[model samples]
Target: MIDKRCSDTELVSLYQTGNEAAFEMLLHRHKSRVYTAIYLIVKDRYEAEDLLQDTFIKAINTIKAGRYNEEGKFLPWVCRIAHNLAIDHFRKRKRYPEVTLEDGSQLFDSMRFAEESYEDKQMFRDTRSRMRDLIKELPDEQKQVLIMRHYLQMTFQEIAERTEVSINTALGRMRYALINLRKKMIKNNIAYDENFYPKRFDQVSIPRGQQGPDERD
Candidate 1:
């Protein structure tokens, strides 16, 4: 019973005009990408689905309250809402499970061995598997920061605010994490290039004009 002719933005505008079916159309258009982003972070299909529903509900309320602003793309705005909601869910739970790529099908497999031959594929798989295991060996704080920075594409300042640490502290934890991961790779005789990871944490100089850590509080 959905109108296939209308675009997402048009559907959103209709919803704002009190057309209920238009909201359903918008939800149908964006649900997959929003769910995928949440699943990538939460790593649970059921949880991702639940979060996706909740996200849409929240978005509806936001629009109803006249708080929705048409920004970049409608999908990315939905994605940001889902991302923040997932983060809040984890914070409230106080313990989050490690995200696995096992459920991600061929898409996950392709990322690790996209450029290699059959022979190299198996080798890359083995190496990447071992590296993931070693990454798990890092301390929780370090692991969270690294995952947020690399996997979630969060900046150092974002990680600091999320983890309730100073930017310098977040940078320091990332530095130590890299050193530990590198040491593990070396010990296992793995030939990972240092450039593949965040290695310039030491070279990051805080700007002088920025407020000091003490001043912000």
Candidate 2:
């Protein structure tokens, strides 16, 4: 039997060895985050559910084909697949879907924003929209690093591995991404304070202070 406490990498190894239960454990562990990532973009429960299944199927296929080289970084890899599929859904439709309050409620639930007042919800939506636009305006490498770091919440090591760059390059791209985003935020009059932006957005626009000598760049 697969131990429940096994790390994702271990489970992935077991699955690749033809132990199906290991894959089930991996799915149970990460399905919530993966689904949330899909729901945030598609904003439709049924559609998100479909895409979530597709995401895992694609993952399973890649693993079976021995093409999944992400190793310990499985979640980010799968999440990127889900994100791409969600974006493709919109691309095929030729327009972004309008998010309703109901859809927003589900998104807020996943994001822990469900308790805010109606006004705060509206502000959150607007802020997210504006931030997306600003992010799209960024240069490709900077934007890619920013999304992996901020959106995928990947560590510099993981980002470096995924992007095939040195850790320093990943850090440099993030620094420039934040600098450019801050400039865009100010020029567009989008407040980065807690009152106007989510804490996540604040992190993207403002670099945190150096915590210690051991802190990674």
Q: What overall lDDT, based on C-alpha atoms, would model 2 receive against the true structure? A: 0.69
Range of the 10 consecutive residues with the lowest summed lDDT in candidate 1: 101-110
Window of ten residues with lowest summed lDDT in model 2: 100-109
TM-score of 1: 0.45
lDDT of 2 by residue, 1-217 (tens): 8776687788888998999999998898788777755654454567779999999999999998989898677887888788667656665654433322221221212222213345534644676667766776777668667766665556898768766779999899999999999999999998856565323211212245845543443
What TM-score would every model get versus the actual structure?
0.45, 0.50
Query: For model 1, how does the per-residue alpha-carbon lDDT over 1-217 read when each residue is reduced to its tens digit?
Result: 5467666677778888889898877776666557656654564567778998898888888888988886525665676578677766665554523432222112121122223245433544676657765766777667667766754456798768766689999999999999999999999888866576543211223566875663443
